[model samples]
Target: MKRALLATTLCALPMAAAAEGELNLYVWSDSIDPALIAKFEAEAGVKVNVDGYNSNEDLLTKLQAGASGYDIVTPSQHFLKIMADQGLLEDIDAHALAAFQQVDPKWRGQWWDEANDYSIPLAYGTAGFTVNRNHYKGPVDSWKVLFEPEADLQGKIAMLSYPDEIIGAAQLYLGVPFCSEDPAEMKRVYDLLAAQKPFVAAYTSDNIENRIAGGEVAAHFWWDGNSMKIRFNDNAPIEYAMPKEGLVGWLDSMVVPKGAPNVENAKKFIDFMSRIENATAQYNFYGHSAPVAIDTATAKYTAENAPELFPTVKVEFSRSCSPAAQDLVTKVWTQLLQ
Candidate 1:
């Protein structure tokens, strides 16, 4: 009987492995709700592998370096344009997605994917500063606070490491266009960042919530979603502000890579995520607003109580920079790091 049982266990091992399908998802850290993922796995009989990236540039670099086996990726709108231009994305057949119809029309047919062929909008928010009100006892209502930090706040400010965000914020502070390409304007932006470098506690995008919650820094450049997450979770005295200059808007989308190993599974996963219930769950979990309209009492409360989560000022979404401009920005970023 023991020998028969051993043979049966050995036979079942391969069968169990065969029954498990795999989907590789590359997304921002803590962006997806684990509960929704588990539900998808249970329904599809698939094992989901999640990989995280700190910024859109990180994702672009990995894919450009020929990283493969990534079935799905979440890229901001600007990076989506670059990836689509490079032919690195697979066409998302709208007909194949049952939940595609559920997506808000406002998010579709945007400049990034004009035809709406390669990506689906996931979440949208603005970039701003998260301030520790306990330490800073001022109005805290302008880009000057970050661009030209007060002496006391020196060496206590954390800015995002992302080029587009940091550089664009500087441009806005200078009253120039966010995507300015002229050498003089670009130089001004670079100089601004160089000047602020000494005051910055750290240039980071990951773990910013923890850093802010722990009071490691008094001010940080962060997304509204993450700011909300830290505020609610830690109950810290953190406050999110949209400077009088304006807010930088961003939209993250889901797309399948060119050579995804599990294309069908990726589509299925996208469809699953598009469902209203799942979308609401993700919004509540990640503290970012999804394109899908959800009307729960919690959603209403969030909208009514937390106005900072939604930016009211002019919102500019960054677009793909020209190759020359991108190279210049990259060079400036390298200098800032050094």
Candidate 2:
């Protein structure tokens, strides 16, 4: 029996070694450029295999089912909190990540990781609008553009299909807190969103840029980086704007799965990415803020190209939904869409 057991253990060693040198990554499609992956691969000598997901919930479901396959994942801050709470994430060792100090103090010590124990803020951006310059008959400064779709843009505007974003826009317009937990307030926001739904041209998240570029739509609700990417591609006299009602912002974070095999390589990669100059390069390429420590260079880059989004560096307070609130938002959103 001892000799048979020894043979089985020896056979499994090769599989374990293969898994150790390989890092399985699940991320948003096109979130990271291919060149970046090449750099990591050449430097670390580790094979990085990546998969894509369309939504956060899908990532969560997979992680819940034992994420033995994924070593690194890109998740929004809220979901990071959820994963940390469920003990699904590996507690990030600050010592292993010496470059943690390179992160902006503003992003650290937040509710998601009050002690900076679990995740690293990778990228930050906002929810906002994209407008075709030719179609805008007036100032496009507020949520009113969507809530009360202007005559020229009527039937030409596209709204984000997600429940939290749609209802949060209404809540911001209504002057209710962005992440209001009050059930009554949430209901009011839901009603407001439903009222504006008819004016919206099909609920959707993707293809907004295609619709706008093709002139199938005149305006789109979009994330700041995505809007910038679209504008960069075509420079078709399109603009992205934040509403006067105040916009919601999100920090996309990198966290390790609890059972991650390549912990050391993962830490090194994260540290390297958090260097201010390196992070700036990513933001310049991707059009989103990197979470590295703020500096003169970061400021100059933002002021030059994305002034509207730069204001967020000082807009410290942001609303994040609790799980209960998320469930409620989902339920009300389903009804509103129905």
Could you give the C-alpha RMSD of every candidate to the true structure, in order shown? 5.9, 7.3
On a 0 to 100 scale, what is the lDDT of residue 59 in model 1? Answer: 92
What lDDT tens digits, residue by residue, belong to model 2 across residues 1-338?
Answer: 23333443453444544443766677776676556655566566666666667566678888999945777888887677788888999887653476778877878888888888777887887777788877775777788887787678778878766665666667777887766768888888777777777777877877677887677778887777777766665676777776777776778887888888878777877776677766666666666777777455544345557564565322223445776777778877888877
- lDDT, candidates in the order shown: 0.80, 0.71
C-alpha-based local distance difference test score of model 2: 0.71
Candidate 1 contains a number of clashing pairs equal to 0
Q: What does candidate 1 score on TM? A: 0.90
Q: Candidate 1: list runs displaced more than 4 Å.
A: 1-20, 298-301
Candidate 1 lDDT, 135-236, residue by residue in tens? 776666788898899886789899876687887777778887756668788888888889999999998876787787778998889888778776676678
Model 2 root-mean-square deviation: 7.3
* Candidate number achieving the greatest lDDT relative to the actual structure: 1
lDDT of 2 at 89: 90
